[model samples]
Target: MKDIILRLNKLFESRIRLGIMSILVVNDWVDFKYLKETLDLTDGNLASHLHSLEKNNYIHVRKGFIGRKPNTSFSVTDVGRKEFKLHLNALERLIKNI
Candidate 1:
């Protein structure tokens, strides 16, 4: 139990961050607006969590313009995929133990 707990990634402790990762892992690219709508979070709240994931290199951000409109999208990195899987496995083990 302790080992599984220890294996959990601290960066993914927040439900917001976990949700962001869960969405990113399955999708190729997700825009900021889509995430905000899906998570039902304010722009500031979502930006803060996105910044954390970006800082950790768990996600990749791309900024561009769709004609005159600005577009920002996010995708999961290789490290993120691996770490998230590990964290999920740890959680699964802990749950089974319980």
Candidate 2:
């Protein structure tokens, strides 16, 4: 129970980060504005979380140009996808036990 709780807690913690991660998992690529709007986060707040995920190698950012305008997209890497799934499963197991 403790182990299951720990895993659930890890994912439950860092709400902003988990939100960003969950969003990235669903889309192949997502823009900053989409994330900001979806999460209803301020610019600075969203940026900070995105940076943390990038640093942790849980997410990747691609900066490029769209019609000569600068664009940034975020996506979760394979490692991140796997981790998210594991955490979700941990929660499921915990729920099942109870």
Candidate 3:
């Protein structure tokens, strides 16, 4: 229905963003390098998508040093988890209706 379609969050419309959420939903925390490798994204590309999610408060970031190198990790917020679930449910409903 129209209401169901409306429930699909535009923030997750991007395959990249959707993939990010999928990974984060399962893992406690994911590092930038691991995400980039898994998603096959360039540094700039992943950074851009991450920035968008961070701006929306759907994901949180932690930056620290591992010995001498800088390490950055990401995790989904509670809000993000709820919204992603709603979006997935909307997609399921759409598929069933179709």
Candidate 4:
């Protein structure tokens, strides 16, 4: 229905963003290098998508050091989980209606 379509979050419209969230949803924390490798994205491309999610408060970031190297990781927030669920439900509803 129209209401279900309207419930979908535009923030997840991008495939890259959707992929990022999908990984984060299952894992408690995912490192930048691992995500880049898994998603097959360049540094700039991944960073931009991450920035969008972070700006929306859908994901949280942690920066630290792994021995002598700097490490960055990401995790989904509670709000992000809720919104992602709603978006998925909207998609399901749309499919069922069709």
lDDT of 4 by residue, 1-98 (tens): 77887898999889999999999999999999999999999999999999999999999999999999999999999999999999999988989998
Cα error, candidate 3, residue 33 (Å): 0.3
Q: After superposition, how far is residue 66 of candidate 3 from its true place, in Å?
A: 0.9
Q: Write the per-residue lDDT of candidate 1 for residues 1-98, one digit (tens) a residue.
A: 77778999999999999999999999999999999999999999999999999999999999999999999999999999999999999999898999
Return the TM-score for each candidate structure.
0.98, 0.85, 0.97, 0.96
- lDDT of all predictions, in order shown? 0.97, 0.86, 0.96, 0.95
Model 1, position 58, has a per-residue lDDT of 98
User: Residue 20 in model 2: shift from native, Å?
Assistant: 1.3
Compared with the true structure, what per-residue lDDT tens digits does model 3 show for residues 1-98?
Answer: 88888999999999999999999999999999999999999999999999999999999999988999999999999999999999999999999998
State which candidate, 1 or 4, has the greater lDDT: 1
Model 1 TM-score (2 dp): 0.98
List the candidate 2 regions with Cα displacement exceeding 4 Å. Answer: 9-12
Where does candidate 4 stray beyond 4 Å? Answer: none
Q: Give the TM-score of candidate 3.
A: 0.97
- Which portions of model 3 show Cα errors greater than 4 Å? none
Alpha-carbon RMSD to native, per candidate: 0.6, 1.8, 0.6, 0.8
Model 3: per-residue Cα lDDT at residue 43: 98
CA shift of 35, model 2, Å: 0.4
